[model samples]
Target: MPNLDLWTFALNCYAREGVETACLELQSQGADVCVLICAAWLEARGVARNQERMCVLEEVAAPWRHIVVEPLRELRQAWRSPAEQDEALRELRKTLKTLELQAERSLLERLQTASREWDESADANQWLSALAPKGSCRVALETLRNAAYQTQLELAGV
Candidate 1:
């Protein structure tokens, strides 16, 4: 596997067809998109899944998602209607969207830093299943998984 960093890997996979919608569905089901992207990166890199490591990544991500990302996202979404009617509000909403993205990028960086030392093996693709929220939409998860697999192949020059 190529040694792409988490943020780059995430951007690649999330840009794939159907991945954004699948991720949004997963997010609506209470899954953290950042953590899910981290899981995809780990899977692509063949990093083995374990409770301890999952916990560690979640620990690194959850607080920031709650305190930083979500609030920005919520505010951005909340302003959508009003912003459509006001130029200044639209500009501020765009800035909020940028901040939300930056927050998510920071979370991905934290995840990558936390998992930097994990050993990789051939059977490490179980991360998506392990990290996905319970009762998540199977179709959405499958879409994400397939995109991640395609991303892995592309990175490997397959």
Candidate 2:
């Protein structure tokens, strides 16, 4: 089973302006691949949150606070029966899924920003490249390329 501390800490990295070594360290520490994928999606989206976005994240993360992190923390501090631990683990998985969906809303917003903001000569890509791992930059480059292709298609009215 995956560790909550590891997952929570890994998720925290998403709050940063860009992906860093800390983010990769989380991956190295056996974080779930699906969570990492969602994190990458969020990173591509970049950080721009309006009131509506903030509310969405809030609503999404709120319920999980109690079920995912809080209970797990309590259990870690004061052990649980095996059956209870099983239940908690199951709950944690569900909580993570909920958080992922909530995060997707913000991610979609970020991707929208990237689509509107991407520039060939702009420093934004440079800034992201500087902060992100090479693999991440490669993926971002691919996304940018796809976005450019779509733009061309639109221009051609196809």
Candidate 3:
């Protein structure tokens, strides 16, 4: 019981009631407009392809140069054997972990850069006085001081 408007119905018709079919319909309609709409829909859905969702996802992701078709390909491979599926999952996990490390490194680098940019000759007292009106500043400063001390202690290993 969903609302099917003329556009959706038409797209559904274009989708030929399927992602691939709709895509083909759009293509048949005209490449330029179809590709743009298809691209937007794919991006919003975070759509990825695998054998099961291949027809739909491919149509959605086709407009982009680098489409995430791994899942779809893996799904098809997995259908033949469980071991292949496990391997695909393992590979995905490894890739995700590497991405996480890279993101953390980027975040840490940005934090260090911001800290350096804020560094000045101002003493703690002066900083506290200036920031006193904003009551939370002292607490934040104390937390930062504690973290710095901990870092120093860890470096010293004592």
Q: Give per-residue CA lDDT, model 2, range 87-137, as digits (tens).
A: 876666556556654544444343334334322232223222333344553
After TM-score superposition, what is the CA distance of residue 144 in candidate 3 from its true location, in Å?
Answer: 11
What is the lDDT of every predicted structure here?
A: 0.89, 0.39, 0.33
Question: How do these models rank on lDDT, best leading?
Answer: 1, 2, 3
Off by over 4 Å in 3: 1-85, 120-148, 156-158
Model 3 per-residue lDDT at 100: 40
**Clash pairs (backbone) in predicted model 2:** none
lDDT of 3 at 113: 32
Specify the poorest-scoring 10-residue window by lDDT in model 2.
Answer: 1-10
Could you tell me the lDDT of residue 128 within candidate 2?
28
Model 3 — TM-score against the truth? 0.28
Clashing pairs counted in every model:
0, 0, 5
Candidate 1, TM-score vs. the true structure? 0.95
Q: Which tens-of-lDDT digit does each residue in 44-67 have in candidate 1?
A: 678889899999999999899889
